[model samples]
Target: MLKIKHFFLVIFVLIFINCSKDEPVDSQETKPLVSAIDIGNSELPYIKIKTISSVLNEPKIAGEMEIYINQKRVLNSTIGIEYRGSTSYRISDKKSFGIETRDASGKGKDVSILGFPAEEDWILTGDVFQAPNTIFDRTLMYHYLGYELFRNMGNYSSRSKFVEVELNGVYIGIYVLMEKLKRGPDRINIESLIAADTDAAKITGGYILKIDKTSGSDVLGTHPLSYYDTNWDDDCRYTEFNSFRSNYDINRNRIAFPAYGAPYHSNKYLETYFVYDYPKAETINAAQKAYIKNYVNDFETALLTDNFSTNTRTYTNYIDRKSFIDFFIINELAGNIDGYRLSTYMHKARGGKLKMGPIWDLNIGYGTGGRVPVNDWIINYNNYVTNDAWMVPFWWKRLMEDPQFRSELKSRWTELRTNTLSTPKVLELTTNTSNYLTNNNAIIRNYTKWTGINYNYNNSVTELKTYLTNRLAWMDSKIASF
Candidate 1:
């Protein structure tokens, strides 16, 4: 009986030993592992926050980190095993992040410092406000207002899109973007009006601009129309108008015109052109004289024979006579105030015909700048002499000196002024626009400041009204002459 009891005790002891071996050791009182670090904070306008992680170099017994923003749980990740040393996370926000982390394991481990995500380092102060009224008035009048007038005047301008939105809880308006324009390689043709003067050698490359639909960025490039000074000498004027009849060649890269007019403004003005392979010097040379006559003739022949409808029609002989008559009338009405420089004329390459382009920049008319007024018939008498000197080529000057040009001008002026001179209608439009400005003062002010205009509502309105009336009158006179 004693032996049997001893055996049973031995068996029990062995079982106990096996059980003890199977159990895991205390792992040296291991600290909890930290896998990731998270950061949470207040939401920002135009910004988004994503994820955060850590980088670990030295081996740790145990690690754990808890991230929070405004006391909110951002992330809880294993520290020691998952990420041995350090890691990074991406954040999406207009502003930088403010985060805090806690070491829960308490294993005497040094906590890693958190860094902001790339491209989100700045903190928005939320202090930006709308610009003043004066600034907006100027910007609206010069850019937006002028654009509207141009459209009304039958000009080909980029379509505009305007909108208002809230940024950071602040209402902002007058945001604009335009459509992209595809510019082809520049080529010399009678159809092009803008860069016709550029030499074929200089017209080398082309570009496709993803233009902003609302802002008219494509039409103005970097410089706004307001950048031009009111003074003729200080203003950058388009001198090619007198010489190039066409503004742009939709199909090819080229600009062409008929004659060179007087230098009314600075030559360093903005002129639209297609991408072309040519040197700037050569282009300028082509613009100054009849250097591309043969090219023009060839372009005209192509236009006349081409299947394109606009080009075919413009190149016809009848259109040429009509264009000549139109030009003569506009010249006489404005006292020959550089019509060729202000407007564009387009011609088709195949038929060598002509058509009227958009009318631009007539704010200084009616002798406003100590020049001759529009109604002064006395200015009409000099039409023949001016035409002979400017419009007619040196050889054709004496031979084409006909009095019929003057008569045509006078007759057109009478018809246009009588039909279009509706000052009250224009004022009504201005009043409605002014109301819109009032409602969206914040956006208007912001844009005004961006354009560098002083904030003064009344003054801006008065100035705009005056300019509008003057410009409208000028347009009426031109149309009548047509």
Candidate 2:
């Protein structure tokens, strides 16, 4: 009887020990990156990004991060992240981020996060409310409007989706989650111009360039041909490069592509203004540079010829006329003072003509800026500046010289005014966007997180609506006279 009792006791003890054993795998696997929350469709989707303290302190450095969306774990990877923007970078406590999807080991998986287009790189743009020396464009819709008009113009433009981001368990404000421009199946859609594509025909197209503010980190390269001042009738101001100390003023535009080397440092003399944007300045070979340079020179030669309109040598031969017209209309319609001069982009396909734009960076368009009178034409660059460092290229003045260009532009404007650019359509977009943000509690949440920040949706919408109504009427009158 004693032995049997002892045996039962031993069996019970063994069972208890087995049950008490900890299952690390189960606990780790079941633990979520964040606690779940119910969200409505009207609200912008919420995202939680987990980060280590090391990364937050140095936002410039890339680190491993985990992402959760609307209560579901989505991505786990190491990413290269950096603070984005120039003026906005200096002003805002809320930081905009440029994120590279690759993990610390440089491994990445492609998946659509928060329903944005499938891309490895993404930008989380903070509202530029904190930017310095700027009249507050309270609408916060300039960028959204810029891209919308670009799309309605039937061009391939960056698709943006609104999102609320939570970093390391802290609620950050609303972000315009968007695609980072690059050569891809979807992004830039040009044939790959790898170093191996040395053939003249293979290399010509598929290049992207931009005119934007240059930073110390920019990979600069130069054309040996002297830089042109583009003063129209004034002889093209030539800057002969002697060395690094050449005090040549930076050109308004930068060379964004065909950079071959990826070196952070280079021995070559940097272009006075053009920063190599693609193919890493270290990667582009001598031949590639010559090709792009010659092509640009040839185009300019045709452009600058006094009899370009009357003669066979026309600027249309070198550019996509429709795209250029649409770009101009959007900029002019928005009254973007920075339109033609800054944040402008142009691209050349392997065999296609130079195309103007996928319009970008318009936080200060409309009546929101103090640079140029909101009601005045932005093309009148001389109205505000006496000796501007970045002058609008003579292209605008010359194009207007051609009767055909003007006719087409006027016709296009009229049609769009009835269709996509119609006032009713624009007002609807404004109303819908505002309601969506409000319904999602995004506006309230965003301003709340920023502490001391105030947002009035109705006022922003009213200003935007009023500006559009007047701008459209003014454009109709001006275009008709043009």
Candidate 3:
């Protein structure tokens, strides 16, 4: 009986020992370098994000993320991340992302990143990725350069910085950590308009609108409009829910698109729609919506009727012409094919004239598009791509017709060319950025992961410099005539 009792005790001890053993560890934290590039010695700030969920598929899923800068943990909070961009997302394996920082309770938490102002919204723009042979902005500086140029021109463009990123445990590549365009004191710096502010002065101003496809991250509590939606129609196609179609066509004529809507129609360029961004589709009240819509209509009417009579309200009565001039100069210099149309942002402050920008999404710029020649204004997009669904607003072309507008544009261009947008200054910015990345081994690290990127870094930089030099020369010669 004693021997049998001893055997039972031995069995119990063995069972306890087996059960207590740590479950076979599957965490890859120790050896997470999936790419050949060794990021241990990188000079750029290292951002490591470990998500609680194994995957980030869409904007709605809030994954718990622990953020570390240079291996020191700074934020351990919930983050909603998803692939951003329409063409970039579909074509590239290395995808950019839209991020929203949230707290433990799932509300937006303001956190300052890379010394920028505390904001819940941020973006991680991936290095350019393309198919075998295509016109890719390989320098990866188009966005940074464009934003810097705009900011230097005395505007509040999105502030961005280069940083190395690690997802889960794998080093992805170098990404541009940028502030998302939102209304804040440090950002757009516009007055807030809520549903309750339906009074005359409060409702007349403080609105952000986008002339973009309804495809990216949707306004909160609203369904995203598919790119396939019929964007242009006789009824103007814009519903009161999210956006409003322009009362005038691209030619300053009455609203009309004979080919009507998307699916590649020839006359789709005739229409334009302004998507409400600030108060958003879910929050903006009817009075606020009506006021903005009417305001835009009034601007268009005033602009279209300028040449009709001296008594007609001038276009200057509706807009800040300086903002327009600066906006035009930056877009023209960057050779931004999508300028004035897609990704364009315009806002109005309380009792202030409508203004253009805090420019956003400039990745596809710097002579990438073959649709228009390098010498022409991008606002002439309609004249080039006759069938594009999104067209430049009649505002730009109409504004250019004004002698004062042309004189101001010419003066601004000449002034900026001598300093801010000068060929040497622009090239210096490009070269310095290039040298910094290469000297710090970031270019090698990024190119190693994103093999689709232009691996010949020097050639890409030379190409960018050449493009800018030629573009600046052309603008200098052409703007002199104005």
Candidate 4:
């Protein structure tokens, strides 16, 4: 009886073990299969990614990801990616990401996935906030054209290419595979500044500054006073560039790199606008902070002086004038509400003048911001919306007040319009980009997912053409007089 009972127990254990063998294995450990696709002669490159994270967190986090270009495997590596943008990030499904390419260990990188001028970091922009892009602004060609105008005009602008990105096997819409603004061999092209060398000589040479949303960690400066400040200049009231605000206490221009906070001082507000970004907060020392602070103080001092334009020591001494003029044309033509405000970047090279561009974000520009049209002039914001959260630099407005600056601006504008920004060229860019997007099956999928069937593609393109035509003409007429 004991032998029989032992035999039954052994059989029961064998049965249990056999049952567990058929269970599905963990998906993470295994390589994922991508759906094979063959679309001949595509407009933009088709990109697909498979992320290892089953749990995708908010404000996207990095995971092991694979990249497929036109169904051919290109890269399999670890990367850091996060949903990026201000209002655009709110989209639940159609989200954009900031991609950081790295080696398998997530340190050190080897990038250049899509021949887009070879940069490690790229942006997968969904561009979905202005859903269905009414009046040509939503198709995203407007923003593309704006950047290309800047680049094609011989100024440094981020090179962008359109891509249909598939994330985790799901088709996300058209994304612009764009270079992230960083100090690099091909980008910004500034001398490398290091934290180990705390000497002011090395530290003051290269720094990137931005004027944007105030962060507690940011280096900031207070506005001198609003246009409506007590000593108001009702008629010739344009003299002040930096001012203290009434409704919002501060208009912050932050130090984006070598991101260190200022030391506590009696008048700390005097030097909060230049936050450290590159060496980062952890590595930066006190001497580096003081060096940047004094450098900025000198620049601001020159800006605020009575003879900013004509003084023997002038504003031109502090900046690269061409960069400023080029940047102004892009913003003014596009009517960027966020111009000189958010995502705006400036860098000072080791012993180099403070430079204006390599123009950044313009998704809401080209009359897309909804606050103003592409035809609207931003040099003076309709003389009504002066209290905007982000105001144009007094430097740009003040420089316009100078005859020399105005002449330079008009000359530059003419040169751009005649070449890259000409009506015909602008139309061609929009049409080509639009055609490429329309040719992709993902275009329909993206729009259906984001805006449904009623969305009008033709009308949007037509509206864009109209905006560009009107914008070019208006700017030409006005700029010539300047």
Instruction: Give the CA lDDT, 0 to 100, for residue 285 in model 1.
Output: 44
TM-score of each: 0.35, 0.77, 0.85, 0.75
What lDDT score belongs to each candidate, Candidate 1 first? 0.31, 0.63, 0.75, 0.60
lDDT ranking, best first: 3, 2, 4, 1
Q: lDDT tens string, model 2, 398-433?
A: 677777788889999988988899989988887888
The candidates, ranked best first by TM-score, are: 3, 2, 4, 1
Q: How many residue pairs clash in each candidate?
A: 87, 18, 0, 24
User: Model 3: per-residue lDDT, tens digit, 7-96?
Assistant: 999999787444322122123432222323466655576665655554333445655444444445444446677666655655666778
In Å, residue 257's CA in model 3 sits off its true spot by 6.9
Poorly placed runs, candidate 4 (over 4 Å): 1-43, 54-64, 91-93, 130-137, 214-275, 306-313, 373-375
lDDT of 2 at 303: 62
lDDT of 2 at 234: 14
Per-residue CA lDDT of model 4 for 435-479, tens digit only, reads 777776556655765676745677778877887788889988888
Q: State the displacement of the C-alpha of residue 325, model 2, in Å, after optimal TM-score superposition.
A: 0.6
